[model samples]
Target chain A: MKIAIVGAGALGLYYGAMLQRAGNDVRFLLRRDYQAIRKDGLSVTSPNGDFHLQAVQCALDPAELGPVDLVLVGLKTFANHRLIELVAPLMQDDTCVLTLQNGLGNEELLAKTFGAERVLGGIAFLCSNRGEPGTVHHMGQGRIRLGELSGGFSERATALARMFNQAQVPCEAVDDLRRARWEKLVWNIPFNGLSALTGKNVTELLRHEPSRREIIAIMGEVIAAGNAQDLNTPIEAEIFIEKMISATETMDGYRPSMMIDRLEGHPLELEAIYGVPLTRATACGVEMVRVRMLHALLELGERN
Target chain B: MKIAIVGAGALGLYYGAMLQRAGNDVRFLLRRDYQAIRKDGLSVTSPNGDFHLQAVQCALDPAELGPVDLVLVGLKTFANHRLIELVAPLMQDDTCVLTLQNGLGNEELLAKTFGAERVLGGIAFLCSNRGEPGTVHHMGQGRIRLGELSGGFSERATALARMFNQAQVPCEAVDDLRRARWEKLVWNIPFNGLSALTGKNVTELLRHEPSRREIIAIMGEVIAAGNAQDLNTPIEAEIFIEKMISATETMDGYRPSMMIDRLEGHPLELEAIYGVPLTRATACGVEMVRVRMLHALLELGERN
Candidate 1:
């Protein structure tokens, strides 16, 4: 399989390395880390193990890479506007574009750029960070969930999952991608938003009673919003709340990506994560008051 | 008129100074600042004027002062629990207890202690700060609105208003104190909660588009909650929104008391300002979602 990973951040590098190790030709499209990665490959330090690729292919421009079998987009959703032009040069007739970014509207943006048939919605359940140029630290779980944007089983999604599983990445193909996004949001909206607003990490947020209650309330809002969209979001509020609380309790106080973005004074992925769902819920006449409040707080914090 | 100022923080000292200047016998009941004020007197630097009371009466114990005509309780609602015993020493049958604290339930707490007949609900439209021990800075408006707790006009409320007006502190007697509380909350819930949550002052919060929208939405929720409690919170949402925006636009980047309390690591008056209204709204089946979210955030922030 031939694959090109765009936006070579921690996610791109981590998964690109895994696919490349499985004998797939994985090329990284980079901007800032292009020079370093081109000179001395990519380095990944993981809890699972440490590995360094010495002869990895890297590209500064999308045109440099000819038509690939799959294009995995790991770019921030804020930069999605440039996707139509940037991704045009890397497509074949059957080329699949999968986005593994946080928040909503990424797959739709891709489908609008490419055709809906060639776009796959993907989510990464991983805790990874780039320590420096060309170096990624894989802290915890690394699983990939991919599905069709229009729902149901797809041969391409199944093949992609099988390929990921062969590489020890633990991939699964679900029937409903939109519901999957909302399921992820049940955890993201409260944990990510509160983490940014209060400057606390996952463990600290779950440990305190007030924040824990807030997390539950915000999660309930998200689930309600999802149900309003007719997405059948699967997990109940209490179940998901307990799941997240117990899952985070074992980690060593990991700071979420949004919290790191806030601490470093960078713009957050507010629109995709918060704005889209809120708008969808409101349009359906469902009031997601808690999520809207969190969205406003994060929006204000980002501007400052 | 003889008066006793309980909780001699900024509001207590400022009003006490004003009433004392009008030839009333004013005594300040102090705790931590008792010795500093007793030794050097209380000083107030105001945009209107600077004044120092070099020989003002200061009492460490409420028992030091006999029953006065009026007892103004200006403590944070978090400390109102101690008022039952503390205020018992300074009240006669006709002595009025006026609370100038922000948020709901202060008058109710006072009424629980000194009966409904002797408790008056007062709202101070002022921005003043205590910079240090025995010193207060009056930055902006100092007008006050006072009314009876049980609603309707009363001779005691009218007399108090007249006395305040004579002291150069503009005062108005309102027909409904509960309605006035709801009116003030239309401003307080949003500004105080957002200010504390986002760590921004009034001007900065009103300046940002997202925070500004949030302020309007939260104010709407508060007004709705007020109406649910049968208080008929007079003003409409849009009018109050525009009113607050215009008013905050002209201010000098002033931080509200809640924000200052958060910065100084003191417990917020969350129960009175946020919790009580939220509970009342919930009990009445009014979904005050935005206010509940803010309450949760402030509660979490206070813990951290």
Candidate 2:
């Protein structure tokens, strides 16, 4: 298989390295890391193991990598405006584009850029960060859940999932991608936004009593919003809270990507992560007050 | 008249100087500024005029100022727990205590310490800051609204207001102090919390579309909560929003006290300003979601 990983940040590099090691022709679309990776190649330090690739292919322009079989977009949603133009040269009629980006609206943007048939929505359940250029530190779990944009199992999504599994990267193909996005948001909206706003890591936030109750309240609001949209987000409030609490307890003070972005002075993916669901829930007359409040604060956080 | 001003911060110094200039024996109970004011006197630069009092009375011990005709409690509400012991030696049988603090529950604490008849609630409509140990810069208005905690106009309150009026500090004696506190909270909850959380000043918050809307929504919640408690906070949401917008437009860029506290790394008066009202509102089943969210974030801010 031929794969082009766009936005060669930690996620892109980590997964691209795995697929390349599995004997796929993987090329990284790079920006700041291009020169470093082109010279030294890419290395990943993971709990699973450490791996280094010495002869990785890199590209500064999409035209340099022309039409690959798969395009994995791992850019921050704030940078999605350039997606249509950036991904143009890399799409063949049957080339599958999977977005493992956080938050809402990425799949829709990709679908608008490419055809709906070529777009698959994916969620990365991994804890990873970029070390010095061309290096990725994979802290914990690295599984992916993917589905076709229009729902149901498709041959392309199955093949993509199978390819990821073959590369030893756990991947599951689900029937409802939109609902899966909403389900992921049940955790993202509270953990990601609160972490950035409060300067607390996941464990610290869940440990404090007031913040713990607030996290539950926020999760309740997110679930209400999802159920309002008939997405059937599947997890109950208590169960979801317990899951997050347990996860935070097990993970040793891990900071979410949103908090990392905030500390680095980068603009957040506010519109995609918070704004879209809030708007949809509000349109259905759901009282998603907590989510709305988080969205407002995050908007102010962006300005500051 | 003999007056004892507790908590000699910006507000304490501003009012104490005025009373002293009126030929009253005003004593400031100072902590950080005791030595400076005792040695160099208290100086104030105000829009009304600039004045330097050379022989200002200052005290570190409540025993030094044995008993005063009036004790003005101007400490931050977070420090109010020590009020019982701090103010005990400063009270005579007929001595009155006025709390010009910026949030809820100050009068109750005072009433619990000294009798109900001795406690009065006051709202300071002033813009001032402490420039140095014994220097205060009064930026804007200096009127105060005061009333007896038992909800009626009393002789002590009238006398206090008259004394303030004589000192060129416009003071009004109102019938309902609880409603007045709620009215003040209509402005305080949004401006103070949002300013601290977002790092935006009053004018900038009102100018931004999203924040402005959030401000209105929070104000509505406050009003609803007030009405729920039968305080009858009489302003409509639109009227209140327009009033705040116009006020911010006219006022020069001013940072709320909460924002200043956050910047100075001091614990915010979150419990008094946001927590009390939010709890009361929630008990009455009034969903002051924005206020609750702000309270949660401010709690986290305190922990951090």
Candidate 2 regions exceeding 4 Å error are A232-235, B232-235
User: Any runs in candidate 1 off by more than 4 Å, and if so which?
Assistant: A35-40, A65-67, A228-252, B31-40, B92-94, B232-246
Task: Candidate 2: give its CA RMSD in angstroms.
Answer: 1.6
TM-score of chain B of 1: 0.96
Cα misplacement distance, residue B65 of candidate 1 (Å): 3.6
B-chain TM-scores per prediction: 0.96, 0.97
Interface RMSD of each: 1.7, 1.4
TM-scores for candidates 1 onward, in order: 0.92, 0.97
Tens-digit per-residue lDDT, A151-213, candidate 2: 888878888899999999999998888878887888899889999887899888888887888
Highest DockQ scorer: 2
